[model samples]
Target: MGSRLRIVLGQLNLLVGDVPGNAAKIISNALRARDELKAHVVVFPELALTGYPPEDLLLRPDLTVRVELALGEMLREISGIDVIVGYPKRQYGKLFNAASLLRDGKVAATYFKHRLPNYGVFDEKRYFVEGTNPCVIDLQGVPTGITLCEDVWEQGPVEQAQNAGAKLMINLNASPFHKNKGKERFDVVARRARANGVPIVYLNLVGGQDELVFDGDSFVVDGRGEMTQRTPAFVEGLYLVEVDADGQVTPITGPIMPELSEEESVYTALVLGVRDYIGKNGFAGAVIGLSGGIDSALTLCLAVDAIGASRVEAVMMPSQYTAAMSLEDARFQATTLGVKYSFIPIDPMFESFLGALKEEFKGMEPDTTEENIQARIRGTLLMAISNKTRKMVLTTGNKSEMSVGYATLYGDMAGGFAAIKDVPKTLVYRLAEYRNKIKPVIPRRVFERPPSAELAPDQQDTDSLPPYSVLDPILERYVELDQSTDDIIAAGFDEAIVRRVLRMVERNEYKRRQAAPGVRITPRAFGRDRRYPITSGYGAETKNEPGGNGPAGGI
Candidate 1:
C-alpha cells in the first residue's frame, strides 16, 4: 500500500451551461494534477460540470442530454489518477446532485447530496431530489467519504460517513460570498471536522454568477478542528494536501494568504463581479456619465479596474447649472485614468425640451419637472452613445439615493449595470479613499465638495433629504434590517426624520423595480434580497400605526 495519499483541490471559476467547455477544462486540469503533482485523488467543487445554481436552465430538456455527453467525455479522457467530480444525475426520471469517483476511466462509486439549501440565493429544492445514503470508498488502504455543499452544514452526513467507517471526508461546495462569509464558513467546517473525528477537505467554486460572487477560500481541517491548509479568496487555482499512512493530514507549505479587511474584500468582490458580468455577457465595453461627484467617480474607478481604461469611456454632460469645479474634476479624472473622454453640453438638449414643453406648462410653476428634464436629456445622450458603441452604461446611483427616491427615473437610473447600487453613500467615500491609497486616481476636491445633482441653481443633496451620515444608518436599519419606524426612533434617531426616511423608501419601490441590475455587496440589496409590492397601501398603514411592529406597520 502507498505510504502517503496525495490530493489536489481544484478551486476553479466556471461558466454556467457551458458543458463542453467546462468538460475540456476538467480534462486538462486533471491531467496536470495527475502527471505534474502526482495527486492520488483530485477533487472538484459541487456541480462543477453544470456550474452552480444553474437556475431554471436545469429544467430544460437538453440539460440532461448535455450533462451526460460531458460526463462521457470526461470519463473517456481522464485516467491514471482518481477524480472526484460533481454533476447532476438523472436517474429514474428524477434529478439528484451527485459526485462520481472516476478511477481507471470508469466510475467506481457515487455519493448523492442529501441537504438542499433553499434560502438566500439557493433554490436547490426546486430542481434536485434529496439524497439519503452516505458513500465511502477505499483509496490505497484508507476509507474516504464524499459529501456535497449543504450536506456538511448539517450533522447527519458527517456522522453517517464516520459511522460507515470512513477515515477522511471531502466536501464539495459552490458557496456564495457576502461580507464576513469566509469566517462563518470556517467556523462551521471546523466544528464538523472535530465532531466527526476525521480530517476533511473543503473545496469551493470561485467566480461571479449574476448578483452572487463566490470567494474560493478553500481549506483542510484535521480531526482536532485545526486548519492544515487554506487557499486565498477571490481567485482560481489548484491547492494540495497529503495524508500519511497513519491517516494524519499535512498541508504542502504554500503561502497562507492573509485575510482582506472588510473594505478590501468588498472592493475586490465588486471588481470581480463587474469583470465577470461584462465578460460573460460579451459587452463590447463600458460607458459612464461622469458627474464629477463621489458616486460617478467611484463607479468610473471600478470600471477602469474591472476592464482596463481603454475599454471605459467617460462623458461629461454639463448642464447650465453645472459647477465649474464639477467639470474640472470630471476632466481630471478621465485624463488621469487614460480613458476616452467627451464633453457634451446638455444646454442645447435642455433648451429644446423646455421649448417643446413651454406652452404645455404655461399654468404650472417651475419644479422638479424641469430638473428631471435635464436628467432625462443626459440619460438620452448616454443611452444613444451606448447604442452606437455597443457598450454598457454603468449607472452610479448609490443605495442612499436609490433608497429615498432622490434619483430621477430613467435619468441617473438609466444604465445596463449599476456598479454601486447596493453601496451606501457613507461607504462610497471610504471606498474612494481606499482606491486612492492604492494609487490616487480620484480628485481630492471631488471628495471635498458637497454632493449635488447640479440640475438647479446652487442645489445640494441635503436640500431634499437628510445628510448621508445620518441617512445611511437610518436606511440600513429600515431597508436592510427591516426595522420599524418605532424601532428606528427608539434607537435615538429623531422621530420626524425616521418617519420621513421610512416613507421615502416605502414610496420608491416602483422606481427600484424598473432600475438596472447591479453588483450586490450588501446583506440586503434592492432587487432579489428585498422584494416589496410597488402598488400597496402599506405606507399608509405605517403612518397610521407608527408604534406597531409588523411588516405593514413597521415602515
Candidate 2:
C-alpha cells in the first residue's frame, strides 16, 4: 500500500448546459491535477460536467446523449490519475444526480445523490428521483465514501457510508451564496464529520449563474470536526490535501483564508453575478443610467469592477427638475471610474411627450403621470442606446424601492439587468462606502443628500415611502422572514405603517414579476427564490390571525 495519498479539489467556474466546453475544462483540470500536482485523485464540484441546476435542461432527450459523449471523451483522454466528477445520469427511464469515479480511463464507481433539496431556490425534486444507495471505493488501501451536495446535509448518507465501512468521505457541492451561508455549511459539515467519526473533504463550485453566485470556499475537516485546510471565497483554484496509509488525514498548516465581512461578501457576490451574466450572455458591455444617487453610484462601481472601466458606459439624462449637484456628482463618478460618459438632457423629449399628450390630458390635472413620463423618457433613451450599441442596461433600483413599488414599470425599471435589485437601500449606502474604501469613485455628497426620483420639482423618496433605515428592517422581516402584519406590529412597529407597507408590497406583485433578475445577497430574493402570484385579491386586513392575509399580506 502507498504510504502517502494526495488529492486535488478542483474549484472551477462552470457554465450551465455547456457540455462540450465543461467537458474540455474537466479534462484539462484532471490532467493538471495528476501530472502537475502529482496527486492520486482529482475531485470536481457537483454537476461539474453539466454546470449546476441545469433547471429543465436536464429533461431534454439529447441531454443524456451529450453527457455520455462528454464523459466518454474524458475517459478516453485522461489516464494515470483517478478523477471523480459530477453529472446527471439516466437509468431505467429515471434521472439521478450522480457522480462518476474514473480510474485508468474507465468508470471505477458511481454514487448517486440521496437527498434532493426542494426548498429555497432549489427544485431538485422536480427533476431528479432520490438515490438510496451508498458507494464506497478503495484507493491506495483507504476506503472512501462519496456523497453529493444535500446528501451531507442530512444524517442518513454519512451514517450509511460509515456503516458501509468507509473511513474517509468526499462531498461535492454546487452551493449558492447568501449572507453567512458559508458558516452554515461549515457547521453542518463539522457536525456530520464528528458524528460519523470520518474525515471529510467538502468541495464546492464557484462562479455566477443568473441570480445565483457560488462562492468556492472549499475545505477539509478531520474526524475531530476541525477545519484543516480552506480555500478563499469567490476564487477558482486547485487545492490539495494529503492522507497517510493508515487512513489518517493531515491537518493543513498553511494559512486558512479569513472570512469576508458582510459588506465585502455581498459586494463581491454582486460583482461576480454581474461579470458572469454579461460575459456568459455575450454582451458587448454594460450601460448604466448614472443618476447622482447612491443606488446608481453603487451600480456603476459594481459594473466597473465586474468588467473593467473599458466595458462600462455611464449616461446622465438630466431633466427639468434635475439639480446641478446631481449632474456634477454624476460626472465626477464617471471621471473617477474612467468609464465613457455622455450627457443627453431630456428637456426637449419631455416637451415633445407633453405636446403629444396635451389633447389626452385636456381635463386632467398633472400628478405622478407627468413624473412617470420623465422616467419613461430616460428608460427609452437607455434602451435605444442599448439596442444601437448591443450593451446591457443595468438598472439601479434597490430592494427597498422594489418592495414597496416605488419604482416605475416601463420607466426607471426598463433595463436588461438590475445590479442592485436584491440589495436593500441601506445596504446600498454601505456597499458604496465599501467600494470607495478601495478607491474613491462615488462623490461624498451623493451619500449625504436625500434619495429621489427627481421626476418632480424637489421630489424626495420620503414623500412616498418611509425612511430606508426604518423601512429596510420592516421589509427584511416582512419579505424575507415572512412575518405577519400583526407579528411585525407585535415586535414594536407602528401598526398603521406596517399595514400600509404591507398593502403596498401586496399590490405591487405585478411590478416585481416584470422586473429584471439581479444578484441574490439575502436569504430570500425575488424571482427563483420567492414565487408570488401576480393577480391576487389579498389584503393586509386581519384580526390577530396567524394565517390571516393571503400571499401578499402574509409575505
Candidate 3:
C-alpha cells in the first residue's frame, strides 16, 4: 500500500465513428503500458472508444451494437493492466458520457460526466445527460476520481470528488485547439488542483476532427498546483508519469515537454489539421494553387510540411493580369520546395471564353464579370487536376477574405480544405515570416508585394477592402466577439467603416455556408463554431448601450 503508482497517459489521435478500431488501439496501448512501461493503470481521453464528438452517430442503434462488440473483445484481451477509458454508455433509457476502470479483466468502477458542454463546437447536451455522483476508484492505495472534459471547467465535479476523499483526479478531454487555449486550460486545471488540495492528471485527445484539432498538452499537477510533467502539443504518443502516495497526498513526477510559441503552435495546428483531414479522408496528396502572394506562399509551405514536398504539387495558373513578379516568385518557391510545378497560362482559354460570350454580351466594359471568368477558369483547371490525381485541392483564402464577401465562391474558394480559413490576413503574414525563419522558402518580394487576386488589370486587395491591420480587428469584434456596431465604433473604429464591414459580413453568409472545411485556430471559426442563418433579415445590432472599449488584442 506504500508503493508508488506508475500510470501511462495515452494522448491519442482517434478517428470519429470508428468504434472497433479505437477499442483495438485502447487494448493495444494498455498491453504495451503493462509490458514495456511496467505501469499499473493507463488512462485515455474522453469518448476515446468512439472518438470525441461522435455527433449524430450517437443516434444510431447499431453504434451501441458495435460498442458492445468492442467491449466483448476488451474483456477477453485486456488483463495484467488497468485501462481507465471513456465511452458512450447507454442505460435507463438514456445515454451518458461514461468511463470505467477495466482492472484484472472486469469493470471495477465507473464514472459518468456530470457536466455537458453545449456551446461553441460542443453539443454534448444533445447527446448526453448529466451524471450526478462521483466514481472514485482505488489505484493501489490512492483513491482517484474520474471526470470528463467539461467537468474540469466547472468546480462541482472536482469538488464532489474531493468530498468523496479522492487523493488524485483524472480529467479526460477531447478539448479542441484555439489561439492561446493551452494557457487557458493549464490555468483552469492548476487552480482547481490547488483549491481542492487534489493532484490532477489531465489527459487530452490529440488530432484534427473536422474543424477541431485537439492540441495534446497533457500534464500532471501536484496538490500545490505545481506541474511535474507535461507532454508536447500537437503530438500523439504514450507518455509515462509516476506518483508516490503517502496516504497524506500524491506527489507527481516525470519528464516535462516544452510548450510551443504562439506562431509555432498555430503553424503546427495548421499542418496537423491539413494532414489529418487529407489522410483520414483517404486523399492521396495535396494540390495547392500557388500565387506569388503571402497567403498562397504560406499555404504551400504548410502543404509541403504537412505531407511532404514530394507528395505536394504546386500549380500556377497565371493570366494576363498576373504580375511578372508573381509568376517569378511562384515558380521560384515551387522549384525551391522541389514539388511538381506547372505554369499553365489561361490566356488562350480565357480568350475563347470571352469570344463565346461575345454575342451574349455586346459593348460591355470589362468589369468583375470578366474578372470572375478568369477565377472560374483557374478553379476549373485545379479541380480537373484534383479529379485526375486524387490530390485534394487546398484553397488559399484566409479568414479576413472569407469573413467579408471578398472571396469568389466557385473560383478561388473552390478547394477541398482551407488550411488558414480561420487565420486572418495579418496572421497570414506572421505565419509566412514564421515559416521563413526555419528556412527561407518564400521569396522576400512575396511578402512585400501588394496582395491581389490577379484576376483583373492593376488590382490590389486594399482597393476593395480596408487595411488588414484595421480590418482584422473589426472582423474579430463583429464576427467572433459579436460586438454591436456601436461597440466597435466606441473602441476607436470609424462608424461608417464599421457599418460597411458589418454589412459585408452579414451579406456573405451564403458564401461561408458553402465554403470548404478548415482548421479552427481562433476562438470562433466560420463553420461548426459560428452558425448564423443565411436568409435572416435580423439587422446588425447598432445598439447605443454602454459597453466600453474592447480589450485590444487577439490578432
Q: Better model by lDDT, 1 or 3?
A: 3
Q: What is residue 274's positional error in candidate 3, in angstroms? A: 0.4
1-555: candidate 1 lDDT, tens digit per residue = 438888898999999999898889988999999999999989988999988879888999898999999988888999898999999998888999999999987889999899999866678999999989999988777788899988888989989998998888999999888788888888999999888778888899998888878889898888888887789898898777777745454333444677889888889888888888888889989999999899999999999999999899999999889999999999999999999999999999888888999999999998888898888888899999999998899999998988987888888888889988889999999999999999898899888888999888999988878899999999999987889888999999998888878877877788889888888887788887888899888868654644333221111
lDDT of 3: 0.88
Which portions of model 2 miss their true places by more than 4 Å? 247-254, 540-555
lDDT per residue for candidate 2 within 94-150, as digits (tens), equals 999999899987898999899999999999999999999899988777889999999
Off by over 4 Å in 1: 247-254, 543-555
Clashing pairs in 1: none
Worst 10 residues of 3 by lDDT: 546-555
Q: What is the lDDT of residue 320 in candidate 3?
A: 88
Worst 10 residues of 2 by lDDT: 546-555
The TM-score, computed over Cα atoms with residue i paired to residue i, of candidate 2 is 0.96
TM-score of every candidate relative to the true structure: 0.95, 0.96, 0.96
> Which whole-number lDDT from 0 to 100 does residue 121 have in model 1?
66
Q: What clash pairs does model 3 have?
A: none
